[model samples]
Target chain A: MNKNASRFLAGPYIIWMIGFTVIPLIMIILYCLTDGDGAFTLANVAAIATPEHRKALFLSLGLSLVSTLICLVMAYPLALILRKRNVGQGSFIVFIFILPMWMNFLLRTMAWQTLLEKNGVINGILSALHLPNLAIINTPWAIILGMVYNFLPFMVLPIYNVLIKIDDDVINAAQDLGASTAQTITKILIPLSLPGIISGINMVFVPALTTFVISNLLGGSKILLIGNVIEQEFTKGSNWHLGSGLSLVLMFFILVSMALMAKYDKEGEGTAF
Target chain B: MEHPLIDLVNISKTFDNTMVLDDLCLSVKENTFVTLLGPSGCGKTTPLRIIGGFEKPDTGKVIFDGQDITNLPPNKRQLNTVFQKYALFTHMTIAENIAFGLKIKNKPKAYIDDKIKYALKLVNLDGFENRSVASLSGGQQQRIAIARAIVNEPRVLLLDEPLGALDLKLRQDMQYELIRLKNELGITFIYVTHDQEEALTMSDTIVVMNQGYIQQMGSPEQIYNEPENAFVADFIGESNIVPGTMIRDELVEIFGARFACVDKGFGVNRPVDVVIRPEDIDLVEPEKGTLTGVCTHLIFKGVHYEMEVTTPDGFEWLVHSTDMCPVGKQVGIHVDPFDIQIMNKPESEDEEAVGVNE
Candidate 1:
């Protein structure tokens, strides 16, 4: 088979990527750089400095950052425990962690909203026991909670995959070479599992940063994230140009993260999914 | 001898109701190169792991330098192991892999650098400091693993088939290199291997094991020439073991002919196993020979011709000689009384036993 003819096997996938991913990105760029009259101007992109948009962007950044941090702190130890248990990738233990991902993501976020509401299940139980009502709904804390709940598996899977692939003999060699348990974890395990950690960070942070549905369902449409503002622009206000300009700004962060991923995970070592 | 450096007293281990090491005891002297030689699943590696503190025997005490270290973890023990696969940290450079133990001990940068240089030089891998471990060849990686273990200057060094991955030539070269290193460093080395020639080439003491039991422990020459039983005799080298009867003191009968021998203590008319090494048999004129046989087959064995001589009664004798004998040619085979080794028949049938004594 000649090389040119053999390349035809990927024809459908190439066309799909270009049509769905590349073309949409190009259209968003064009919209971000032009007005409704089709005249190119920087005004749409610069409109991000407006107080409402700026506040939403910062809130999204803060809430996503907190959610990513919590996911990392919670996921690392869990991944390490799973690896220590010698759990296979398709084992019931891993299936439990992935079970939540099987549920519809919006339903999961809405379920959290019900739990965090003033008279929700948790608050009702608390009041019945003469405890204080569970209070942090329609706030950044609830949004962060929803983000963590929805995306925790994103942090666990890659780290677990990487950890499981690390050779047991390497860890044994480290210990035989006089490394304490703490030193072995830091010097051997962590350094060896870096690709997975970076992948997990990218997975958790990207989704948490761009989520509008969780904020809308749990934040009562009051605490506006950048995603919510963009949603309103596209759906309610019918401002595609401004929404695309903000999306372009968000894409810049995503691109930076992708560059970091390329640097750390060139071999795609942690990509189990 | 000198006070033992490491003593594993009555060690026994079982995994899931299957015994791996059964009441095994071993002691090592300081600066001696000891080898545990056995076939696979003979439990050779378990003892090495126990000494390195990687495993705890289900029922035994590991005593090092007269202090009990039975419960010590690998990190707490003053020992290091070169794993079967080398196990070099792929994330680190060669220099960093060799410097791992030193860094953990919090050695100064200058000292660590000097130690790394010395270790690399010792392993003959000088100038590989910045090279990544994954880039090195199998032989080079094995050398780096050796350097990594030796850099710590531990009291004892354990190697678990460290050269198993190398080619034949590299394995032979590393065998000498390991011997030289042991002499230069003066650290006790406990090596585990299933290769008999390797065990003979490098070990000061060879402990032959079988089915989780020590078959024999001796110097290489003793193991080769004076095997204690049929198993040791067969395992060490080639031998022609024949069933015979001990007629009287210093006499044995085989093929209905009497032959003088050196072994003793078997009662008259008692059944015994008689061993004769092939090289010990000589081709003589038919009338001057002890037995007459026809050459059945011949193979050129580089240094000699290995001829199978069949006696009139139909027993085949494997003979190694520089002089080639033609097939079907009648010849006389001579044996010296000193070359015949008589042993008692093993109590149990060992299907794998194949060697004869000389």
Candidate 2:
């Protein structure tokens, strides 16, 4: 009976995946080749290469790169410290990081808005302390900070898992062989833990490039990223063809980056202690 | 004539209120191969770690070359340890593993190459420079571990059951190779193993330990022939220990029969334990020897047959011989007087009286 049920279960999933995901992807490709008036042409694809669309592409790429870099710089040390020190405290810190993620993304963005506004808690505190009130809500820094806060756990967990499994004996062996603390970390620990960092970068960067909620709340409708452009094309302008083409382009970049990361992961095997 | 290279004086260690090493003192002369022989939990590995500077003794001094090094970390000590697991860096190539120490010392590139080559050659692992450690077999990986430790020319080398992971035949082969390498390098080696045969075959001095205390320390022959206590005799090899009474200077009575032995100075008559090795007992025709027994069990070992005989007084004695003794046959057991080791039984009233008079 179980085998019969499993056989029945397998057929629908194949059909459902083909109907929902595969069919829509095929339709997106077809639409990407169509024009604004619905004729088959490359005109819509060429329109994505326009100056305004190019600016959105550059902004998404730059922001995602900065966000990924900041997350790595912050998370790698946190992961190492968590792997080596008090684990209960580490889990509590991880909980704090993930609790922000569990809260509604819109809610988190709104919270940040309340904190960064001119009369918000941040400016109120600054004024109370007789410090200068700074404009932070409508800037790239606010978007990058929000991205880092939201995506840090994605960078940390992978690196932490890898660091925790590294044999303590290997570190001792290096030290016993007269390698100092710094050399051991550089030559042994970092090379061994690189795969985790690559996975982390891929995790943080790809999603960050397509995230629009934080930008909408923090950048005050001033910053225009590719995701924002895609949303505007799809919903406000009613141009699904252009949005699908831009989505495919973002996907291509993500695929290329993931391929490069896979290559690095393969090369890093058996090189760390 | 020269000072001992390593001296551990009255070293003691406690972990969580349990004593691991209790006032352990040992001194290794230059270039000597010493083995710390013991069962598990005997503090053998702890002493090696202490000497290697991986661990610190709570109350002792580790004097190397007449300088105190008890507080030094593992890197500062002039010793390297080959762990039982062959703790090779899985990420490094064979060459990198061997050159790690040389690189740490900032040696010249050519010098590092030469030392790595020489150390690899000594371990019979030449031309494995480019191979990843994960690709090597267990024996090959062990050799790489040896190469890595020895490349830096440490003053003393510590091996903590380094061949323990190998199969029996490979373990025996590596034992010979380890002895050959030790002789070639002339490095002071402190080896830890529970295998008595390996200890006997490889050690210039064997220190037998049990329950965190050194039971006996001597050459292999001395340890096997003249064990200091029942524990040493039992641990080093198989022995049939029987309760006896010391009847005279060289005579012990066991199970209502007088047996001649060589141990003396306990008293005219005192309770003692007599130990006799199975190989030392000879079997003769029944009713034509000093003692008679019926062979109850015969086990065929490859090189020798081991027989258990029950004497007329119901005491069991083990005998080993190349010729098989058939079960259920009456056999006469003859042991030389000197083959018996009689130890004074602990603190009975008779022993106390004897001690008081002495």
Task: Report how far off residue A72 is in candidate 2 (Å).
Answer: 2.2
Report the C-alpha lDDT of model 2 over B1-358, residue by residue, as the tens digit. 9799999999999989988898999989999999999888778999998888778899999999999999887888888989888888877899988988888889999999998889888988888899998899999999999999988888899999998999999899999999998999899999999999999999999999866677789999999999877778778888888888999899888887788888889798788878899999999987766788999999999899989999988888988899888999998888899998987564555323222111
Measured by DockQ, the strongest candidate is 1
The residue ranges of model 2 lying beyond 4 angstroms of the native Cα positions read: A1-16, A37-40, A43-48, A86-110, A122-135, A267-273, B312-314, B346-358
Question: How far out, in Å, is residue B117 in model 2?
Answer: 2.3
- Candidate 1 structure quality by residue, lDDT tens digits, B1-358: 6999999999999878988898999999999999999888889999998888877899989999999999999999888899999999999999999999999999999999999999999999889999998789999999999899998988899999999988999999999999999999999999999999999999999999887889889999888776777777777777777889999988899888788888788899999888788888898877877788999999998999999999888899999889988998889888888888887787665523322322
Q: A1-273, model 2: which lDDT tens digit per residue?
A: 699888798989989999999999898888888877788877666766999989988988999999999999999888878877846434687677667767887887788889999899999999999999979788999999889878888888778777887777677788888877788888888888888888889889988898888888888788998889888988998988888888888878899988978887885532232
User: Model 1, stretches more than 4 Å misplaced?
Assistant: B283-292, B311-316, B348-358
